[model samples]
Target: MANPTFWVAVALFIFIGLLYYYGVPGNVGKQLDSRGKRIADELAEAKRLREDAEKLLKEFEAKRAAAEREAAEIVSNAKEEAERLASEAQEKMADFVKRRTASAEAKIAQAEAQASAEVRAAAVDAAIKASESVLRQEITGNAASSLVSQGLNDVRAKLQ
Candidate 1:
């Protein structure tokens, strides 16, 4: 009635009042709260996933360390076994050499005894031949035969 501008301002205020009276502000607040809650839930899920990943990494590290320790133990056992086998082989070789050396020495001693016995037999045969020759040169037939018998008896008694 007085100014049209004043009427437009009043109509704008009435429109704002109607929006507030119909619960639009409360609906907007509820939507904002739901969005915040959803964001918080997603953040919590992300934290749980990160923690699970860390736990898996630690487990893998522990398994790797155990595997390395087991491998080292296996290598050590193999080395000890190899060393024992080598030591046993050395001992066996030494024993075999000692036995062979003893056997060789016994064989050498037996050969020496056989040679000594043959030499003694040859010397006895030669002495008998020389004694017979001397006896034949000094005596004739019947006297030589009688002296030969007595010398043979004396030689046999002395040898026994």
Candidate 2:
């Protein structure tokens, strides 16, 4: 009872007894359990949010793939339409060229026929003039008149 070690041991026992009487250890244990439950709830919420985000990502990916397919289909249809238009244009050009060629040939044939008619008319006039000059130089009086009239009748019959 007079020793310092004995006094220190007695003081430590009193402090432990006071802590138990005040319910300090039980309060600490309850606070630790509440903190653990809060942490578990937060982990569960995080897991649920992650699953929701994954589902949204999958939906967006499916939408993007559908959009790409639709775009490709539109491009393919446009290419087909363009090719069809180009072929139609070529066909129209070919038809136009054929019609123009036919028209040009018709005009050329008409001009050739007109030129041949003019040449024949000029030759007939030249022949008539030559025959008139020769007959006037060779013939004379009433006998010559009769002969000229007979020759003119023969030339007219041959021409017809």
Highest lDDT model number? 1
TM-score of 1: 0.61
Give per-residue lDDT, candidate 2, residue 53: 95
Best by TM-score: 2
TM-scores, one per candidate = 0.61, 0.66
What tens-digit string does per-residue lDDT give for candidate 1 at 57-155? 999999999999999999999999999999999999999999999999999999999888788767776787788788788787997889897996788
**For model 2, how does the per-residue alpha-carbon lDDT over 1-160 read when each residue is reduced to its tens digit?**
9999999999999998999999988998999999899999999999999999999999999999999999999999999999999999999999999999999999999889888867765676577667767887888778887887787667756764
Question: Which 10-residue span in candidate 1 carries the lowest summed lDDT?
Answer: 151-160
Candidate 2 clash pair list:
none
Question: Which regions in candidate 2 have their CA more than 4 angstroms from the true location?
Answer: 1-23, 124-160
Q: Which ten residues in a row have the lowest lDDT in candidate 2?
A: 120-129
Supply every candidate's count of residue pairs whose N, Cα or C atoms clash at under 3 angstroms.
0, 0
Q: What is the lDDT of residue 38 in candidate 2?
A: 92
User: What is the model-wide C-alpha lDDT for candidate 2?
Assistant: 0.87
